[model samples]
Target chain A: MSTKELCIHLTELHAKSLLNDNDTFLFDCDGVLWNFPHIFTGAVELLNYLTEQGKRLFFVTNNSTTTQDDYAKRFNDIGYKAKPEQIICTAWLTAQHLKSINFKGKCYVLGMQSMKDELEREGFQICGGIGPDPVPSDSNAVTVDTLELEKDVDCVISAFDLHISYIKILKAATYLNRPNVLFIATNDDASHPQNDEIVKPGNYNAK
Target chain B: MSTKELCIHLTELHAKSLLNDNDTFLFDCDGVLWNFPHIFTGAVELLNYLTEQGKRLFFVTNNSTTTQDDYAKRFNDIGYKAKPEQIICTAWLTAQHLKSINFKGKCYVLGMQSMKDELEREGFQICGGIGPDPVPSDSNAVTVDTLELEKDVDCVISAFDLHISYIKILKAATYLNRPNVLFIATNDDASHPQNDEIVKPGNYNAK
Candidate 1:
């Protein structure tokens, strides 16, 4: 079938997925369809198309770990019809990985709270925030998130949080820097669209 | 006049002092007026009485280093009337001094952005924000708000910036431990008022 036919078929499947609550369509935002400034040609049309077909749409990203408030604001700023609930990050996913592995203890989270809150509900405690700052060595710290081959274990995941302050990025780097620590991340995309800027501010840059 | 009458008049005068804006009636909320949950009975009354007189009011506190916006919110939360402009803090006041004294060059800010912005505008360059969990090096930043004070410049000034966190405090105290450098604090009041909470988050406890 032609690309147009394929898109239409995907929309039909999206509608079926939403009806059955089984849709898990994760699309890379940048370069897959359009370039930076994210005011891409068919952005809204795609979302509307999916929603019309009742597809559960989620915009998974690697470079977000701030807050839902920031995410909604940024997505709106960039003309993306993204609800805070729809955007995902590696930080959020990592929180889950820790929980699935029965990781317990306070974490100094350097990322967003939504994912951290999810992890916390599963009995993980965040000692502090993890991001671009140096992670504090609180006795309660469990681990920082990264996706390295030789790192130790807990679980790894990702989500988007925007508080990319130097302290956040730097501290997460420090935890991953440890030889004994396990590291995991999400997306690991080369580039992501920020409000008006392109950011590679996540683990890949540290790598 | 008799002591009773004299006492009554002094009470009335102290009540009026709130609005006097003459000598700058200063009170430390933590220890002077009240403890953590209560206020000195006379303080609010005096403040109200002063407001009736349209006096210029200044609240100086040492315990907190939150931004003026945060302070204003705290004031509103507790039923105290405050404009962000009317509040004075050691962190704020210290930033003022640093700027006024021509603190220049890339210096690590041992305080929050509210404090950093004030100093940065005063012509000093901010090398980085002192992390919430600061390192020994992060703790010991070469910041000189005043150059002429003995030592090889780069003096550290204390403000009631609550965001200084534990590590920053350790660094500040350690930096001060050295005899060659100068350490200055903007105020010595034991605490500041925020709604009902009397915080000792400032350097009063650190001292």
Candidate 2:
């Protein structure tokens, strides 16, 4: 049989063997556990059943918009028991990855509040993410001077952001020009599901 | 050439290239950094010189008797500017390893206070370590019942313990008999440097 046919079907014995081989299970959040406003039917029951069988369950997600504390609260509010440490989101993963790579310099972030929060919680120095918007000036007669990048900025991280601007991207690009500077992105999803339609996400701005 | 002759005749140019190729350095704590009761001369100066050259440094040690916080305090007290996060001791490594392996059940530890503290900080449920010793019974009429291990214990970690007891070893052995239980040891050094003499350490008790 072709590989396409095998992908669409699974024998009962094969499924049973796959399930019995591992003591740990990892689940994704959006589109798998819950989509926006509604939780998947019987998802809670499946999680409880896994727990009853002494399986170690971890929730891994590409969603970097929500903090681990917020995710934990959402899980408990929806009648599912979860701790903050059990939710491994992309924001936390990015911080851990940077630390494991022995990053010691400040970061230039083109991201949202949760990403900044996660990095700061790990004691990383971050810059150019959130602040008051730069005031717009229409004076063209003013002399233009060469812009200098922040020498202390040595890392660039891009994630989903509702308030992304050209200024943030410029700073991130300046940092990227330096040798040995680390660059990372949380996810590369072009579009995400909404209530009734798919909408373009922050990846467009990240580019 | 003999091994002793080669060890005493290293070329200075070779040593320079070896140190210049790496941007990060990890130093061991006990014998490499300092011996007992005396800090190595000019060690602090060398660390500062490395910092001046923008080299990232970390202290890695197998000593499980001190928590990260205690180690940081010791460094600062001895006039070295070091943070707790820059030090990776066996206590912290053990906790991280358990988390990485997705351990979900309680742990039974035959170890020291630092090991228990580090595990508890990471929200691990630990049992059977660091409590008041059971009262000694001198009468021959009393009979000890069959040992009952903690049913929820699914991991056993053995480290250096000043007050090693047979009861803790029995509990560890009982947990190890169960299938799928993780067994970990911080270090297996037969002896360690004391104030003046090399004395046998806690490995025998751990076994």
Candidate 3:
């Protein structure tokens, strides 16, 4: 078939057929629902319509800097009804995954406080994510021989870390060098959109 | 030739023949001349003997934290005759390469002060290599929107950075996203030997 024939326009008839064909819908948050502070037009109405129809709706996002509860609150604040269970962000998913795997050791996180909070909510001991672990003023002072690495760290989780430092990277790398230590990254996006002219580095660049 | 025949033992006859065959010798620092603080037993003697024979010698190292002059001092401290001209370390090489390319733009470095000094010696403007660029006290305070990026950074150099931080990584990635920005990495080693029991993360791990 030609490309034109294969394309399906989302007309009112097609929308009705699509809604009837699917019992659940998954929506990405960043570009679809809203772009930061401004919610997209008609997005809340569509979500309410889906909810009224008793359809399952999930707001999935790769953003790990925000927790599931925060996302739900954001959705609610923007006139869309959302529950924590309906939000599946990376921070929540990472915690869930570790909990599912029965991870019981200390985690060294290269991420924001949101990720740490989510992991702590799952009853995991955490370190290295809350603030900056800068190298000493004397650059030569903090060498690998001088670094005090925690022996019990069993996992290194990399997400959107604004406080990522050489010391943090060193600790994570040392922990990950062990044979059994697990390495997990929330997302591998090259760049994150900030505003019109600015973009931020993602976990991929940090790695 | 057979594998066994290809191997040449450094016997008296073979040593003489090999010395006559090559007018220059390139040596690596870590495992060859010394293993930090202790010079190998015969390494200095061999270097001196080579120098007496008028054989040109170069000490090449992937270590970027030490400048050419520093390496020469290290060699002299270890009782080996050496000069700054005989050292071809990554820091020196990186500076030489940039100079060769006639690059006059400012550099955003993810490296040590040694690399910065080397670059400065070449008369290039530098930033981000001296100390820690920590995130703000509040985790949510520093976002991409608030980051003040330098507009004239035309190059990003990645080496052995003890002060590698999220702010530095963000700046490097942002600068690198431009099509004309050059990204340079000194070495891609996975790990560096610290002591008998510890291994440090290399530039590859940081990348």
Best by lDDT: 3
Predicted model with the maximum DockQ = 3
Model 3 alpha-carbon drift over 4 Å, by segment: A1-9, A127-130, A205-207, B1-9, B127-129, B204-207
Candidate 3 chain A weakest lDDT stretch, 10 residues: A198-207
Where in model 1 is the C-alpha error above 4 Å?
A: A1-207, B1-24, B32-42, B112-114, B120-123, B134-155, B159-183, B186-207
Per lDDT, what order, best first?
3, 2, 1
Report RMSD (Å) for each prediction in the order shown: 21.8, 26.9, 3.7
List the candidate 2 regions with Cα displacement exceeding 4 Å.
Answer: A1-207, B1-15, B131-142, B146-148, B205-207
Q: Candidate 1: deviation at residue B19, Å? A: 7.9
**Tens digits of lDDT, candidate 1, A154-185:** 32233343333333433444454444445555
> What digit string (tens of lDDT, one per residue) describes model 3 on residues B15-87?
9998999999999998667878767799999999999998999989998899999999988987886999999
lDDT of each: 0.49, 0.69, 0.82
lDDT of 3: 0.82
Better of 1 and 3 by lDDT: 3
Model 2 clashes, total count:
0
Q: Rank the candidates by TM-score, best first.
A: 3, 2, 1
